[model samples]
Target chain A: MAEKVIAGFTVNVTEEGYLTDKTQWNKEIAAEIAQELGIEELTNAHWNVIDFLQKDYAETGKLPTIRRMKKEGGISTKDLYDLFPEGPLVKAAKIAGLSKPASCV
Target chain B: MKKLLILGAGTAGTMMANHLNKKLDLKEWSITIVDQEPQHYYQPGFLFIPFEIYSERDVVKEKKQFFPKSVEYIQAPIKLIEAEQNLVILQDNTRINYDLLIIATGCKIAPDEIDGLEDGWRKNIFDFYTFDGSVALRNKLREWEGGKMVLHLAEMPIKCPVAPLEFLFLADWFFNVKGIRKNVEITYVTPLSGAFTKPRASAVLGNLFETKNINIVPNFNVSHVEAEDNKLISLDGKEVEYDLLVTIPTNMGDQLIERSGLGDELNFVPTDKHTLQSKAYENIFVIGDATDIPASKAGSVAHFEAEILTENILSYIHGKPLEAHFDGHANCYIESGYNKAFLIDFNYDVEPVEGTFPLPGVGPFSLLKETTINHWGKMAFRHIYWYMLLKGIPIPTVPPHMKTSGKKL
Candidate 1:
């Protein structure tokens, strides 16, 4: 589903106003999540990961594995990008709005 | 020339109505479902309400919205189930007869069951088992700055046993968002030994508590709460004080179950584990929270039970032997805050072992472990619950049974 682009920006909160919009996906939080993961803003590299994760899933389908993600990025060698210090799974999954895997916790 | 009467229009009743509505010949068999409440609630979403992830609109819809058009819905409160005469009395003292009765009357959270619960409920203490309560708790949480918050389960056999844990997990995420996670000391108090019932599950969940830094006060049997003083007194005489209390009170089956002389002390119908037939009356059957089945009182249990119950009900009608095959299979997603979740799949005999699910070794989703895949799977379930499960339409690939195909031993 396309992100809801509602009317006005009601005081786009920064790190200082953490309590402002915790449960929702705002531009600021998304940006923070993106920045923490070193994902370049609005690039095909970033959008590709986001779009693939957005599809409906079943038990049979394969997850976007590290190898697959690397191949899809059109990189010469699959480099494990050190995005967030707290594990790629946690940082990538959180930004993707996926559930915290039991193994990850 | 027998009629089937189903009580309650909640998840269990709705599933039974839909399942039987399609199978039974409408020309010969008449099916009527009775429920006092006019609306149906997406109960799982209630867990997300306090985090403001879900407004009331996201979790609630009309009861008639889900009921099959073929089944007759009686919007009246049941007074009693007169089993001997095979008739049920309405609150107005009107009676309707039935040859076969399917008791789908689900459980209710009786906060009043616990001492001091009724007095401080919804004001100082709140439960998310209901829509109104969830909304109130959400407002309370939003206004909160920081304090000692106690998330409690008054007793077991409550609808959705995993909800309270989900609350704590989300609270960790919620408090972090508010920059007050460290400020708000969250303590989860449950009657069970660990964070959950099964030892393995509790261990997995217990580890999560350590990771989140949420305090776990296990085996603290609550004697009563002192809301005025903002304290909980356990049976063992341990007192844990809280500034804000989130409680899942003692849940009981519908009062009509007791009124009918068909239920046990808790108003839960005494049912045969495999048959789902009421022990007291062979012609009567019970499912969902209404039955005293030794299973997790969750929606998936009800779904699995409905599948077996439908086959049994039909078999009984045709003078065939009832299939004693329901394995108490249940699956739940534990939402650990910070956008992570865990999934568990188990049946009556099997413990929740760590492994991948549905497809076993090649799962897109993992089981008994935290992963983003499980988190998305949990969110995806909301859509599945509305579109497939309640409508008696099974998910394309997932079977009713807890298959070991993809699960690691």
Candidate 2:
């Protein structure tokens, strides 16, 4: 197991730096992690994506795919890409305090 | 009596041996096949290894298992092909003369071409092209949590051009299965401007990349790998950082082809795209990854080429003009994760369009659209490759020619 201190909170991670424990995540932690990842501020629009990803993942134990987000999360394709420059699912899932979603890419 | 020699006992060579053995008279013609590897690897199965969908045992078999008993097998690495003298020189200094030759020595992944790739290979950077590489990568992925996972293609004309995208898809599935999906950032970097080489398929696959949240770094002509810094630098001074990198390196034809001075700049035999015959040598035929044809470097293309080459070879032996022409036909299964896959069938003239395959509007398989049946077909092809294809038995209804009966424009 690996560990990282993000926003002054110690979290267990995988060797590749994925959060091993999802329960340690919170909005403040997400904000700090987002800031570390180079996102200056978390807008409501970003939170809308993050909150939906978090709740959906908790409920289903799966990260909703980009298609699923577009269908159910009510976010347009353009907005989703805008929220996360190169990795929308990656960044959104991180801010939502969850691990990555499995295959389709 | 005449001797027909085949180089390499891979997909193309093995199939050619079976096809010719049945067609030629044993009393009149003797056939010999040479290859370095003792085992026949089902190349497509390499994709399933890292995902744990396949094991090494599933992909490997004794090369002799497929060769007909009458055909002589020489287990030796080729040193050179003395094309001028119609002879092949083996590494052991033995020579074999032939009246007709078929070059099927397939392409190989050349990692050393990119600076710093050899230093990080199998440590942080890995490829699935080799059996050992796939097994090593599988072990790595088993323990890896995920962070900035990048799947890259060093250049085009690699075997199964769609495979890199498939790996990205399967990685998504693999991480999700491990419950670390949020931790992995999947990105696809390619030399091509789009997701695939073909336009329509590129658009569809590109959309899938976006929908799957797999980032695309297009037009990335990789100049080198900075393993210590965890960056891939392109020729134009761009850099992409990665925690784990899975790449298909620059693919080149057999070195023996280069040593013999029989190949082009990349060591690929210059082949007549329509005839499957070597442009430089009249009596020599080229198949599969060995040929510098515009067709996709795929098993299906080799199978299709073998059919035409079979007829052409028979004509050449009889002192008749070769009438058969290859259409650069290719078909492949694109696994989109989950239980669905897409099937595409095309020729030199046609691109993969949406429709049913092998039938007009009544296919058991769908083309250019994802379906569970296509996934089953893709899985089922392993059996077909071993039993029907390598045996030279023509698959019913799946003709060598690309038909437009079921395709939608």
Candidate 3:
């Protein structure tokens, strides 16, 4: 996982297909995913959080925990769910450079 | 005995399956039918859907419901067909071997084929061919106040030839009933050089277009739809501006037909001009929109061909010579709106002539003529199609061969 800031928010980016192993996506595909995520824009403030999330998930086998999200990304469970209606934390985790947990779906 | 596999459970295939199921004995032979989609759409009802005359419930039925009970139904996606090997493979890796194959797969919509069509499609512009599109248009019409409205045919070889015209006519009626007739300007755009394909019918209906104040944009080949500008620009750059754009999207054949490499550029199977047999393979036959026959691709044409092809299949079963005897016969009822409709019956050689049908001069229905009886006949066909056509039961009074009786010279 590659932890990076995207659209003023922390997101973990990883290779496609694995819960833990995410691939490096280019700016265009990243922007498309961001648009789908309602982020739409990639700003300097978002870079670090996205990079950290990506790096942490890449280093570890799972996405950042809520405690980690609160400590690192400054987002609550409610704020996470608000971003991803299907459970923002879990759903955005799909695009956030993290692994898709089997039980998450 | 040779195995027979039928593709598609649509109008033609379902009817053919029922017809063949009754004739072929299972003790000596095996019969199978393959189709991807489980639901069978009442295609004709798509016309009424936009006007809220019919709902999604009325336009759709399960394909399995209309299929013959005895035939093996393979509800799976077709991967590819190796005509040379006389086999069709499914996506599941199941191979269906057929000594005789019937391609009843119908034509499909190809909106992306045209330039800029994909942009406005279903959003700024609409097509009533599909269930979703029709229902969407219905919803759009609900909130619509009124403006320049256009009923345009992108090109010919559409499923129902009269449907676009019928839409325009019905729109007029619908607007009038809603008391928005004055606020809206209705236009009928076509690529044809005249009001219709046939000259006699064109002169009559063309006059009606004039009288009803429905602007006719004849010979306009649409190049693209400028949604932001709210204009339909033709190939020559002639533009028709509209507030609500209702277009009949381009129609093409199935993708499986393309994968099989047995079809033309449009994926419609190349078939015998007269015999209705597949040109690529000897043991294969085709009917309906799936075939590249130079005939009007309509339900009536399929009904006409079914009567003739049954005899041909019977001959083939007995190891006899195949029959080359099907004139491209088609019959359609033109809904002129206001409780009146005109019936047109003709073949490849004969254009629709003004006359009494069935028994000629003594008949109840008139051709190229509109009456209350014709409108009733059109409505009554819904019942007949469900009971007779899909069941493969014969239609009384009307025959496959078109009659010229009561028709004046």
Candidate 4:
């Protein structure tokens, strides 16, 4: 674990930059993380996914997979990819201030 | 007399039935096992079928042959599990009440879940996850002239998560032996960020994949398959063309779980990861691929779960605390082709590391490294699975909980 400054606040994160403590997250922090990951702006579509990921993780103690995000998060696969390019679930979880989705090793 | 019911006579259910048979008092309890299928499949052998290493005969066995004499076996498809009422209704509306229930109804591939996949299924695209699928694929591979072969995994939480990797490794060897290795270009497509999920194992296996000349396309969440175009379309509109497509479709739990309203998004029962008890019902327990426990859905995991589950079930019966806990221990043999295999041992928190198994620094199987001895261990497991594993016989020196003593950490 390492400490990184996001939105003028130092937060604990993994080597890959995923937040170690999800509770130390805010909308401002999300924007900063997203910006660092190459997204210049955080849109409502991105917020919807981030909100769903945080709420789902809080309730289930597990990050939702891309399939779960599509089934339960009311987002289509294409839209998810459109919102977070490359790896949707991985990127979305990172921006959402959640640990990386286990996806079952 | 008290009634204890076991559902689905697959590997997990059969082992539980056998474990409880000797442990439970026959005079005080009556054990009944139910399953629709008459033949119990050695599912691990399915991995060998496509490569023609094992036939249908080797994997097939009579379900009744393993059951103890005291346990009554019922052959009927279950309609629904009335968890609230502690009743299970069969397809014919046969109602059976139980004091305890063990849900071991394992998962199956739903190829129909993906759009346009059915149109090419068994024609150009094939799956080796099932008996019929493996047999059909074997037939197709028998005469395949060799072209671009793509092995795609539809989603995660699949049964034996390593099977897809094993399939590709074996295919590499199979084609090499058939002298078509030069002609067939193999590509592995996965939804994960890498070849395997765990970092250490992924690095090791990913290197092996490169050494075998297999291409890997990671983070490819498939949106649909375009059978007409002979192309796989990812959610991001990325496409991969293939001459022959072998895919592991989305695996979901038995529909009976869904009908009973006892499952999660994928119809897997919500189970206590450590205790093997159903979170929804006190009288109910879940094991194997049917449980949403975040463990790899493999027979080896089930074998480990059975040991802990047997003790927990007994504790539940006696109204005591569930002491035994499953550590998500999973031991798997990865067939890497050319009569060599890799053995992996890990639990909930541990990833597979290089070490010796059963004995530390002794003359035997090596872990996280490809070796002929590990391949022989995998071959020998067929006998152990049949003669000992299902019969509730403890495998000597191999405990249910993963031991960290020999592990390098």
Candidate 5:
């Protein structure tokens, strides 16, 4: 893990830029990370998804998959793609201050 | 006598029954297994059926033949699992109480989950994930002239995660042998970002795809199948047209899981990844494709899980700690066609890397690289699965856990 400054706050991050310690995240950090990942601005719709992801991860201790996000988060796949662009789950999870969703390898 | 009940007489349940039968004292514990089907299918052979590599006779056997005489087998559909009361009710309304339960009801392909898919199913679209589907696809391939052949995966966490890749690889070799390789256009479409789940394996297999003239369309999360237009439309509006579509549909656990109110959104029981125990109930355990573990849903995974689960069950029964843990161990053989295949060994922590298996440096079977010997090893596994694995007998050299020796880090 390496320390990086995001939104004027230093935090630990993985090599892929995901927050290592989710507790260090805040709204400013999420918006900054989102902007860095090419999401121009965080809309209310975007925040809804981020909230769902963060809440689900905090409760389960595991990042929800794209399927779970669609089914439980009450978001359509089309909307997720529209909100986060390419690779929606990875980008949303990163912005939500969670590790990348683990794919069954 | 205390009762030990096993649901679903498939690979995992059957293995557990055989295991507990020998381990549990007959004077103290009685074992009973339940399933709807009488035939035990060798699921890995389903991949070979489309290529005509194995016939129906080769992959099928009576489920009763594999079970130990001490264990009672009930051929009936499960209606519901009353977890709170430790009672399982059958379709005939027969209720059985158990001191402990093991759920091994595996998953199956659900084509109806996708819009417009059922319209073309068994017509322009086909699947080989089931016995009848494989046989149907074989008949379809036997007479069909070559055209655009698209192999698609509707979603992730399907049983035998590498089967679709293997199917494409074998299809390339199949068409070539049929002298129609030039006439057929082959493509692989998946929601994943690459050819395989692991980065290293994906790179290796991606290079092979290039060599074999196969095309790949990644990150294409399919929204629906347009049967009339012969197109697969993504949620983002991207489209892929095909002459023949071979798809791995959305795989979900048994409907009984839903009926019993014991599953998640996908109907897979919430399970503890390490202990193989049900997260909600202490006496109820889960194994194989039935659980929502992050491991690949394959028979090899179930085999590895059976070993750890047996020890854990015994520990639980004896009022000891559930110390034995499953590391999500999965060993699979990918048939790349033409008597060549690749072997992979991994778990929840380690991704499959280039290594020698079983004997470490002295391996007769190589891992992560294509070899002719691996092909033979895969072929030989059918016999081993029948004679040893399902019977709860350990292989001579292979262990249940992943070994890090002789691996290229």
Candidate 6:
């Protein structure tokens, strides 16, 4: 396990860079993570997705799906991709400081 | 007593052996199946290894486990097939004479045919077709830092043509789980004009690609892999660069087909498309990935061919005109990631159409549409492959022929 220090607080991550603890994730940590992920600034649209994901994970204990985001979170697939060019749900969960989703590839 | 020799105890060979053992008169005939390798693989399971959906042991089994007590299993690599003399020469220089020969010696990946592909194989390039290759790719993907990942197909007529698309879909999901998908730029490069061989299926698959944000680089007839530049040069002078290349190299039939002087330019045995009888030899039949048929090189096609070939072989033995005919029928489950998959069933004449499968209106599976039921169907097939299909038991509802009863248009 590799640990990343955010605001002088240590956070453990898996070898693949997924955060091990959900509690260590904060708004400040997300901002730093977003910048590191090539998103220089976090827009309101990005926060909407990130905040929804955090709430969804806390409630369901499952990562919100792409369809769920599009339907419930009011985010379109295109806009989701635009926001997180790599992947929407994946990056949203990461930016929100959630653990890796348990979906089988 | 007459001898029936079947080469390569893979999917086609194993099914034929089991099928014939029950049909043939044991008192008057001897059946022998040969292969250099002793392990049998449920090849479809190979695609799931890199995604961590299936482990290595889940896909491998002893070749002898599928064979019955009556069939002879020879574990030796074949050196040559003397088609004229009806003799198969082993690598040890021994000869086995047969009255009828069945060539199921399937195709293999030929990376050497592509220039510079070997230069970075297993380093920056990998394939999930073979067991070792799949395992190596699993490790590479597990530790893969985000970069431009390109999944490519060198040519068509490769085994399990839908596999590359499945890999792409799984990669989308895999990277998502790893939390580095944002760092990865995924692209699919193919020789075809679209995502698949068939137009209807291609349209559906192409849409999936667009929604997934995976780039599509079609009609790329690869000339070579310029490893130094990290570019795949097409014959048309086009190039696509990537940091990691996972390719399905040019696939060719077994070397034994070439040694026997019985194969086409690509070393696939030329045969009657419907009858599966070799064009050159009357007593010889070819099936599976070894034949130069227009059907998809897949296990389902082989299973379908085995049913027709078994009947044709019996007809030939009795000096009867061959009655059963293969329709080049093939069906496959395409895993579309996110625990959903789609099913496609087609033949030489039909493209995959939208509808329900097995039961027209009451399908537990859908055609050309992704569903969780389809994913379960794909998972359940592993057991069906080992217990029923390879064992030659008739699979219910799924016949050897492609019927249009359930298809929409």
| Strongest candidate by DockQ | 4
In the order shown, the candidates' DockQ scores are 0.01, 0.01, 0.01, 0.47, 0.43, 0.01
**What is candidate 6's lDDT per residue for B1-409, written digit by digit as tens?**
9999999899999999999999999899999999999899999999999888999999999999999999999999899998889999999998999999999999999999899999999999999999989999999987889899999988656889889889999999989988899999999997554675444665566578878989999656677899988999975567899999999998889888888898765688878888999988999999999998777899999999999999999999999998898887888899989999999988866778888888888787898899999999999999999999999999999889988888986
**Candidate models: Cα lDDT each:** 0.75, 0.84, 0.75, 0.90, 0.90, 0.85
Count the clashes in each prediction: 15, 11, 36, 0, 0, 0
Q: What does candidate 5's lDDT look like per residue over B252-337, in tens digits?
A: 99999999999987889999999999999999999999998888899999999999999999999999999998998899998998
Error of 2 at B351 (Å): 0.7
Using TM-score as the measure, the top candidate is 4
TM-score, candidate 1, is: 0.78
Per-residue C-alpha lDDT of model 3 across residues B1-409, encoded as one tens digit per residue: 6688889888888888888888887777777889999998878888888888778888677788887778889999999889999989999999988988889889977888667766777776888888888999999999899999988777556787778878888888888989999999999887654566445666556577777778888756677887778888875567999888888867788998888898765677878756788877888999888987767788888888877777777777788888747787888888887888888888766778788877778667888887889988888888788878988999877888878777764
**TM-score-sorted candidate list, best first:** 4, 5, 2, 6, 1, 3
DockQ of predicted candidate 6: 0.01
Interface RMSD of each: 18.4, 16.1, 27.4, 2.5, 2.9, 17.8
TM-scores (chain A) of the candidates: 0.43, 0.89, 0.53, 0.93, 0.93, 0.87
Question: What is the alpha-carbon lDDT of model 1 when measured against the actual structure?
Answer: 0.75
> After superposing candidate 6, which stretches have Cα over 4 Å from the reference?
A1-105
TM-score of each: 0.78, 0.79, 0.77, 0.95, 0.95, 0.79
Q: Give fnat, all candidates.
A: 0.00, 0.00, 0.00, 0.37, 0.35, 0.00
Ranking by lDDT: 4, 5, 6, 2, 1, 3
Query: What lDDT does candidate 4 reach at residue A77?
Result: 75
Of the candidates numbered 2 and 4, which has the greater DockQ value?
4
Error of 6 at B238 (Å): 1.7
